[model samples]
Target chain A: MPTFADRLAEAVRQKGPLCVGIDPRWESLPKAIRDPLRDELPEERAAIGYFEFGRKVLELVRPFSGVVKPQAAFFEQIGPNGMEMLQLLLREARLLGFVTVLDAKRGDIASTATAYADAAFAGCTVDGDSFPVWDADALTVNPYLGRDAVEPFLTAAKKADRGTFVLVRTSNPGAGLFQDLVCNGQPVYRHVAAEVANWNAPTRGACGLGDVGAVVGATHPKELAELRAAMPDVWLLVPGYGAQGGTAADVKVAYRPDGLGAIVNSSRGVTFPFHPDDPDWEAKIVAAAQKAAAELKP
Target chain B: MPTFADRLAEAVRQKGPLCVGIDPRWESLPKAIRDPLRDELPEERAAIGYFEFGRKVLELVRPFSGVVKPQAAFFEQIGPNGMEMLQLLLREARLLGFVTVLDAKRGDIASTATAYADAAFAGCTVDGDSFPVWDADALTVNPYLGRDAVEPFLTAAKKADRGTFVLVRTSNPGAGLFQDLVCNGQPVYRHVAAEVANWNAPTRGACGLGDVGAVVGATHPKELAELRAAMPDVWLLVPGYGAQGGTAADVKVAYRPDGLGAIVNSSRGVTFPFHPDDPDWEAKIVAAAQKAAAELKP
Candidate 1:
């Protein structure tokens, strides 16, 4: 099996490093998609509409993108049945040869962290042929509790040849309130950037990049450049490119000169373009996403 | 509706601030409990055993404790069915008048954070009378993504009268690696501690305590005292008191003179006491927990 780094490198090389986000926002979907969530029983809503929409998303994005980042909260909001559907969607994506990054953003103490790593990466197998099809090639992790909290995910990723993207800097308006807070006159995010580089030291891939990565929001262009420079050997999962006011130019700082170090993500901008408007939403979205990906190409 | 601080205060007053953690270690259970997990199909091993063991645990401790900290990762590791069961168990514990602290430790950016808050406090209800019962009065949050990551929880918590415990000084050995790293000469956790105080400023309860809380591992006694002083208005969820090698004396720093500021947690120390050599596990374990509670009481 190709390591996640090798697979990501190959995909980025083939598809221009654009990673679409699958966030099935009920309010933003077309009438055809939104009706079921609004009208059906909760369980039926998850099993029928949610499942179909997620599957359609997988099918739609598979032909064009290098990877798909599925925001776990959107699926989890519908409860366990929604998660079951997520597993199905992940299996389908994997079968189609698309990398799935489970954007769970999970962080906890050691034991709990180990359990989450096990849950997300190694799904239980049922009958001789029935296996739990987990949808992620890598997971998004929070680095709050320090190195110990992150070590379990790193250990699991190493064992399974998977990957992790630790949140070093986010794109939200209030992100700076804490992340940019100066301690000893330097921003806290810089400290996190250094830690991300340190954690990935042991897991360097054949391309000299580590399986561990950092999530540096495109919203902070200057910080992205600084963080990129700080962690040269780490892969970057850059979010907040389109809807969050981050332009293609802003995201470019996240990439290396070779355009191989970063995977830029756009969630609501691509997944839910039809909210409160657009007569031909799906077509409009597909076109918009393709355009966005093109504009973002190195 | 009683505010989280008020409810927590009432529970503590009634139950002596003893917070029991429901961590179902499959290997430590009785033969009868272990039998089901061992004999069941691999797919059934975790979920069925989890629900059964979880229900038993709820029944056993419901009468004695003020709060139950159900480790979300344990149930989550068993898959969707386990999550569903965890929700059911949480509902059962609530009916028994025990506050539930779903130890999910989930943290993320804007919209994602809103979804998690909804899932934990104000659960989605398909029908008016029959809503999915969110089994937690409080939640453990990760503060890595800045204040924005935690703001959604605080918003929902204020509205719902729930509470959140942000990770501060942890019990793990490697906690100091990053959390203790000095930025401007003070440890990173000190910065987080001040934020906890800031976020809790407006939601002060009748007891003059705020719903926003901090998770200060009891193992770091001196740091706990410093953190306690830093966030005077915030409630403290002190873990590592028993199984993780923290003593009751070490945890006392988390409490106020009025005994209104903290809840000490003991997971493995109280739950899985029958480790082959220990005689009279249940009685001994119960006695130890009671003793620890008494020792910490003001």
Candidate 2:
């Protein structure tokens, strides 16, 4: 099996850099989808809707996108059944040749972190064959506990041939309140970016990007450029495009000159299509995402 | 409903300052316990063994400890069945009169964070009357995503009268590498500590502690003092007391002179009996924990 970095790089090359986000926003689905869900309980609606929508999304974007980032919170909101559906969705995505990134921002002490890595990547079964269904190719991780906490994920990823994207700079408005704080004349996020690069050094893929990646928000264009420069070998998973107020131009700096180093994610922008009176929401989303990808093309 | 601060304060007064961590390390259980689990599948053993051990732990510790911190990753490792057992264990802890701290360390963007908080503290049901059990009284949260990510937990916590402990100065060796970075000539964690105080101010209990709390490692005695001083209103959850190499003296600074402001945690130290020769591990654990609590008594 090709490493996550190699797979992601190959996808970007084939799909012109578009990575669709499978957000499964219940309220945003078409009325045909929403009407049936209205009668079901919130939990049932979310679970069934998420599975149906997620599978449709995978099929819809399979021809146009390289990877699919599933927001874990949406699935988790519906309870364990939703999680079961998420597992099935991940399997479907893998079958469709899309790299799966499970967006679970989990961080803990070393021992617990190891357990989380085992849960997300390596099967938890003692025999390994009859494990849980949903093991993503990559996962989003929180780096708050510093290097020791993150080391377990790295070790697990190395052993499992999986990948992790550490939160260095987020796209949310309040992110700058702490993440952008300058410590000794260098931003805290910059320090995290440097660490991400260092962690990825030994795991550099055939494409030169490392298995360990950094999540640098597209909303911070200047920081995106600087972080990209700082972590040349690290794959950048940039969120906050479209609905998060980031333009395609804002995300351009995240990619390498060759356009193979970054995967820009748009969650609500692609998933929620019932914003106004747009007749063909799905087609519009596909076009918008393709356009965004085109704008970021090298 | 009593706020988390009020409940915690009352518990502390009733059962000393010891907060036992219910980490069901698979390797540490007795031969009778391990013998049944040795050949069973991981999922089956995790479901049966973990629930049985955890239920017994809750029953045993309820009379002595104020709170039981069930590490989420341990149960999560076994998949959906493991999660079901976690819910059962949480229910058992509450039934036995011990406050449950779900040590998930989850942090994410806005909407997602709300779902996690709801799943852990507030029950969400689907089709049947049976809902996913909200077993925890409080939860451990990661602060990497900044204030927005944390606000959802705080919102739900205030509404449900629950609480959260944000990761601040951790016990691990590499904690200072990122947390201690001098941002604008002040350590980053100090800023987080201040925010914790501010967040807790609105939910202060009669005992002068806030519902919002900070997780500070007891190993850093000096920083613990400084963090204690910085976040006077916030309850401090001090980990790193035993196996992580922190003593009663090291944790003393976290509490006020009245011994009313902090809860020091010891997981493996209290749970895993030192002498295999001891006939009863439960009795040994209770005695050792009682001794530790007495040493910390003001």
- Candidate 1 lDDT for residue A160: 80
Tens digits of lDDT, candidate 2, B131-236:
5545489999988788998999999888878999999899988899889998766899998887888888989978888899999999889999999888887888
Which structure among the candidates has the greatest TM-score?
1
lDDT of model 2 at position B22: 76
Error of 2 at A33 (Å): 4.2
Q: What DockQ was computed for model 1?
A: 0.53
Q: Give the Å error, residue A106, model 1.
A: 1.0
Report the lDDT tens digits of candidate 1 across residue range A171-208: 88778766776766668788878888988888877777
- TM-score for every candidate vs. truth? 0.94, 0.93
- CA error at residue A237 for candidate 2, angstroms: 0.3
| Superposition error at A296 for model 1 (Å) | 1.3
Interface RMSD values, listed in order for every candidate: 3.1, 2.6
Error of model 2, residue B281, in angstroms: 3.5
